[model samples]
Target: MFWKTILIVFSIFLSILLYRAYVVFTPDKTIFESCLSSTANHSLKFDQNRLRTFQKLLQFQTISYEVNKQNFDEIKKCRNFIKEHYHDLVTNYSEFVDLYDIAEYSLLYSIQGKNLNLKPFLFSAHMDVVPARDLNRWKYPPFDAHTDKDFIYARGTLDDKGNLFAMMEALKEYLHAYGQPSRTFYVALTHNEEAGHSGAMGIAHHLSQQPFGHNGQFEFVLDEGTTILEEVFPTLNNPIAIIGVAEKGYMSIKYRIAMASGHSSMPSAPTAIGILARAVDKLESTLQPSQFGRGPELSLLHGVTPYLKFPLRLVMSNIWLFGPVIEWVLSRKPGTDALQRTSTAVTLISGGEKENILPTSASATVNLFNDFSNELEKSLSTAARKEPLDTTNYLACQCIVTEFIKIIRYTWLSKKDSSLEQSVFFSLNGYSTLNKMIELTVTRDKPVLASER
Candidate 1:
């Protein structure tokens, strides 16, 4: 009788749990519609005339090419166009001048503000647009800046030109209204961010030498990065602007194995390609350990705590209560969980070309992001040691040859203050106009990761 009673109660509990899961996961159409309406009401008021000007800018074919000779004319035209339009703005400010010459196909422009004693504010954006791949795939011509009801469609619409034009518009408006800011604002438009920022480096080098301010430096710098998502968190009623506080450091390591080249009919016990493939498989299967202790991700979770449901809200608010749960969730997909931890991936592989002939050489490339606080050497060592590198079970005739791997590391450091976090939050809130419409009912569940992505 007791077992029967327990079973009935257990069934009721399971049904309730299932219902709650359904409630949590199901899409709320009303909320989505409301969000859409909100977005429409607060969308940027882009001027049609200004958009036409931008369209002309887009049509200029300022596509950056790797080889200077290939894109010479396009680059020259873009340079001249920028110089002519910005002449007035440049002439008004005394600090700006022609810094360097573009070798064949490149352009770099600089603008300085009126504050002599203050440190300069550098705002950079590239002029060149990526070449439209598979032109037939585009709804309209890639260069055609088409505007229907809302968006401006072009090759560079989101990648950068939209940002470039937005910055220019902001500057024009700022100059018209405020004359010049308390600090010097330097506007740098480079020709090749897509290619590799060779032009950007030239500009950066030039600015580094200049007497930008009283204390030898720039007060602040802003760059385009991750965008704001309105419903990333269920608890937050407003959009969350993710200002990339720190970007992941990257390192590439190459692994190579060699064996005797021979005919397929008389193959060695293990071929070079087989050995390398096995090593790669082993390395991939045994990934570096994940440590999700703390960082911007935790900060992000805390920032969105207000929007979470009852138990989740309570748990996320107090890390001690839900640390294990958070770790479990993050561990599921290391790539998605990478925001909170270091990640590794075996990205590329190269081996035998001819099917019949046994090739002697094979190689694999491993890419990884290490913890910020850890030293590069230590991280590299840790990665090397932890990753599987066994060569035991090879063919009898195959001589396993292993090459010493090279590790190349790159870091991006920021000098901005933490207050920028608040600024980002405020900017997103302003953009969303959520503060103004706080009283409006949000009837749907928050946007999921798939939707946000």
Candidate 2:
């Protein structure tokens, strides 16, 4: 009887495994059906003057040095440069568009829509670039916007100015093609995103004071975050854009130890430095518990699992059973490891003065990027249950993932050559992929919000 029971249990287990492998792991073509399709406007060719304007915009030294000490002159020049280059937007469309200088350097363009009932969208980009500290490491001058046969080499070419320029150009193009949009939208360009978000906060404060800010009534807000990643997944052949649903929050813990000082010749059993060192070592050795299959990364993995090859697809699809194995593998690499759990980094440590004397005090600071997905989930669920109409609570969590595409200067590729299979990634002829989003959405007869995608 016992032998018969064991056989039956084993047979059931085998059946379950087979069912999961074949049924659960099967590809679902409909998964990304809601994602935005590349529209015809993506093929629009940018003129030489527009490319020149992009290159000139990159030449500005609007570097954020410190919170109080920023290169304001360069920022002002950049703002003026934008206005001068897009003369049509400022002069021709002055009635529909209103420009405001928030926190002195930040620029906010409020474009009025024909329909007042539609909730406006907000798009944000930062103007200032981090200082180019290691000039010797750069192949070209950091601010030069050097154009080779393929790429434009500059500090802000990829980060934010690229997005900013693309947005402005898209707006101008929309006006020329479709005229004033049916849905209202706002573009906010902050001057000090790298150093501090004061400019952003100023704009936020200004918007909050307006009538639309009452219930967070906007359609959606798109801000700068992660870029498009190529070869992010090992088994997947295609590049995936990471719309960051949310960013990891961080906390810092500072440890300080104080002990009696003595000569090096006669040391105590545990000195202050020794105690601190051991504590730091323990913290380093013990990692935070992995939160795999719990966060937005789970959503990401599920979305991409069908595209991944063979065993990986099977493994990702059956995360409930293979989570520990996948977690172990993911934890091996720093970049991939961060996606699995909260990460710890000992950024600062200091202790002694002279070699002869024993240190009296020692301190260490450990920074942790917390996996706050649980908290976020709860907040989202609560907001949805309590107030379905008020989407302000949901705005912070929605994000876009896109690859940092190559920006080809002065050269435009044909539609056939520019396909993803050719691996061109995208070009700046129309406004690259990031900016093309704005162009496609507003220009379409029916506006498609990023959240819907």
Instruction: Report lDDT (CA) for all predictions.
Output: 0.56, 0.66
Backbone clash pairs for candidate 1 read 235-307, 269-395, 270-395
The digit string of per-residue lDDT tens for model 1 on 1-453 reads 999999999999656654543443343445335443334323345777678768877777777555342354675686677667656565665444333454333444444445577666666566776678898888888887777886767887776767777877777656555565666565666666655434654455455546642235456666555687875544556676777665555555666656556899998755666656666776667655555555667766765665567566655666654677887776676544776555667888787869899876777777767554444455455554543334234221111111221212211212442333333222211111111100101111222232342
Off by over 4 Å in 1: 1-44, 60-73, 92-115, 129-137, 212-215, 307-309, 333-335, 386-453
- Quote model 2's TM-score: 0.72
Candidate 1: worst-modelled 10 consecutive residues by lDDT? 432-441
lDDT of 2 by residue, 1-453 (tens): 999999999999767765676777677767557768455554346567777888999999999886668898999999888767777776788878888887888888888899978988878787888899879999999999988878889989877899899888888877876778898988888888766555755676666666666454567666665777888877887778888655665334454555566899997755667656666675677666678878888888887887887677767777888889988998999998899776767788899878999887777766666564533223223322322111231112222101101121112233433132111111111112111111000011222344764
TM per candidate: 0.68, 0.72
TM-score for candidate 1, please give it.
0.68
Q: Quantify how close model 2 is to the true structure by its C-alpha RMSD in Å.
A: 17.1
**lDDT score, residue 336, model 1?**
48
Q: List candidate 2 stretches off by more than 4 Å.
A: 1-48, 252-275, 350-363, 374-453
